[model samples]
Target: MTSNDAWWRGAVIYHVYPRSFQDTSGDGIGDLNGITQRLGHIAELGADAVWISPFVRSPMRDFGYDVLDYCDVDPMFGTLEDFHRLLDTAHKRDLKVLMDQVLSHTSSDHPWFLESRASRDNAKADWYVWADPRPDGSPPNNWLSVFGGSAWQWEPRRSQYYLHNFLREQPDLNFHNPSVRAAVLDVCRFWLEMGVDGFRLDVCAFYFHDPELKDNPPNPNRPSGKSFMFNPYSMQRHVNDIGQPENLAFLEELRGLCDAYSAVLLGELHETDAEKLHREYTAPGRLHLAYGYWLLGAEEIGAGDLYGLVRALGHEAHEGWPAWALENHDFMRAPSRLADGEAPMALTAALISMRGAFCFYQGAELGLPEANVPFERLADPYGREFYPAYPGRDGSRTPIPWNADAPHSGFSEVEPWLPIPAEHRALNAEDQGRLAGSVLARMRRFLNWRRTRPELRDGNMDMLDLPEPVFGFVRAREEDRLLCLFNLGDGPVDVDPPQTGFGTPVEGHGLDWASHAGRVRLPRGGGYFGELA
Candidate 1:
């Protein structure tokens, strides 16, 4: 499965939010050219691919997710030619490029929506999900947006309400319409023709809706077991609103297109039974990889949580491939939220050790925590609506600091579209790159080392039921059986090897571990990679 066509199977995909990666344009916003300049960083870090967040033409309502033109690059992110240069540069460094495809919805300003809403008799009238208001003039059904209130937005022109799972400005496309499906595929073809390696499908589970427009049932159990509390989205089970079986056929159609170019499809599954959905979608000719809120939505992740993750998505060969991301553009950073503001290295070690591909968000290597973006500086629609309770995703989306002392930390000549965090300044690449044990250096060293281990790359996994504060797994392939462990708590943890006979430490894996008596001892933020007999 390690063929040229299947490189994503065990790939390490570094996620780059184009708006915050770098800014060569000096417009205070990162552009394609900026990403080109930073390609070397990802290359040197030894990532197999780069999953770029959406940079398409948009109104910036949801940053770049509300695409206005699927085939064009937003001027804020540079022209189409700029993307070609970035793609070429990345390939030159042996790094694959996966562009984000936001096929579920488009900005209300999109021409398709414009033409569809004009008169009701237009050729594209059915291109978007439109339903008539009930006798009481309420929504067609009881559906709530993850952002806030009702999922339905009234449109005066057609005397109908359109379904918008997100912001009213972003209307959901009618995937039941074959024309819409064909057009979305055309969007994929345009990019594939432009030579991208693959696509990371944004809000992928949302592509299809229940044709019957049924109401979703209320969730029996409300949100629990995390510092982050409840919202209306947490109250519903989302049975009919999403996870429709029709989505599988469309995915097959997408897979066939991707197979033509040997491109991969990585879908973003909503956390409504996401693990179960992940298995179904990745069965045969479906998404090459998928991820959900798994552990990302939590304010913090403990040793037990990590253990539960392994149980839910086992390391067995029959299970679907997963693209794990502890931190992303959507929520709090790992160091700030994964534990009590420590264990960055341990968290990363566990992530890379997992059985399938994973996405490492930018700034993670630098150990950047979630910046305190006040309500005044918030930009995310979800955060803005649920301000104090949610605090928004802007904290995690702050600019990546390249130079600790440079203005705007080398991200831009001017202040970035979002403010840069002071905590991240000292952890900038230049400073951390020079340090021997900095987060950036340790991550780079470990990642580069991992590329040499076949067992870590493509092996059957066995989740280890180790002692408290020590949670990890073993990956075995032929003659190579490697054990990866991390100390998820503070102080030191000493544990007997799962099977103690011929355990030997692997060198240059960038963890400060030791052996005492017969037990492996790990200090706070410690990790161990060893070979087993």
Candidate 2:
């Protein structure tokens, strides 16, 4: 493969939640054209690619997650032509476009489900996860939905129940069926033939289930953190319901199909043991890159945990690569989660400097904290159920604030599906783009400057043994080696450089830095990027 063919390795992908990106139709929702119009914004931010979330035909029961048709765009988002235009525009900007594929499940309203539930036997009857009652008329197992209660919903026509890891409206597909796999692969071909760069496989681990249908063991350590506390779903270890061994073969098959088209595949892994699963899932023939919620859903993120995670990733030399994301549509913004009192810009520098590929969530460049959406306006079903306790993801999924002074914050002529908070408006891209110290400005400057450093791309990353709250690492390849240190603490800290030796400061990375007498001073949330002398 040529250097350009392996574009996903260490690539910076910009995540776009199309529903909240921009509204070209003025229908209170964002569309493909809106994303095309905003491509320049992402390009200016220096991302290598764009991973647009689901915009496929759907009932919107789970807001495009419950895909009804994978082959076509929903009218609300735009026609297939609009997607073609969006893709063309992105490529023209040198941005690779990756479509989000929710192959694990389909909307209950999907034609496949509609037929599968029609009778005990049909052509597509086994296309979804369906099982008979356990004599007492209860669900097949003790599996629970990630969104709320029982993962099964009884279908009276066949006196059976179907599994749904999320909302019941989103029925889990039965990958155990060969024809089902082929159909989904055909869906992938449809898009690749249409010229998409690749796919961001949604809930990739949930593709297969235990054929015997055993009950998942109770989660011994009740989950708690910024992510899983609100739901009962966190109570189980998820043994039989997901992360099955059969998934590896299916992923390899998917990889084969992707390889034929010279496309890349990124998988989202949901597992308690992320580091272990990350290795298994991304190994040689499986996913090109994979990421779990280890960092995104952490109870508390500190330098120690960050150091451990990077080391565990085996950045020294590993076949399977990993991806990083501080925030996405489903989680609270990074500033609200990890910033504490630190500048969001510093977090940006620290993450982008890491060895693996990275995902830059839309609106994060402006350092926007989670918006405070009122309960009266909540739209996410998962969030609505656990409202006051766990605000779901509505806050992070709100519309981007493009212009501070424009009505509706320049997201649309009509009010957006989700409101743009005043706080976000204050940090709008138009205004932040003009400020030198703003997170947006710093992110752009650093990203562009980092682009010139070849070692950062294919370098061997070694985690530096530094003091707590002052994480350090080195990226080296051949003759070039760069020393990167980040102050993840609250106040300024003066610490000795890594005993191996801190190099001469390399300027132009756009951070206020100081180094002298082999000791470096980093202000709150500031970082240092230097060339190893």
**Tens digits of per-residue lDDT for model 1 on 36-81?**
9999999998899999999989989999888999989999999998
Model 1: lDDT equals 0.86
Q: Where does model 1 exceed 4 Å of error?
A: 225-230, 500-502
Q: What is candidate 2's lDDT per residue for 1-533, written digit by digit as tens?
A: 11898778878999999999999898989999999999999998889999999999998988899998899999999999999999999999999999999999999999999999999789989999989999888998899989888999999998899999999899999999999999999999999999999999998989999999999998898757757777778788887888899999999999999999989999998866667778888999899899888768654667898888887766766657889887899888776776373334566677778877898899888888888999999999988898889877999999989997888999999978888888888989999999998888988998988777877776878788888788888988788889988887777888785865767788888876687676889887778877886
Model 1 worst lDDT run, 10 consecutive residues: 221-230
Q: How do all models score by TM-score?
A: 0.97, 0.97
- Say which candidate scores most in TM-score: 2
Instruction: Assess candidate 1 and give its TM-score to the true structure.
Output: 0.97
Clash pairs detected, candidate 1 = none
* Candidate 2 clash pair list: none
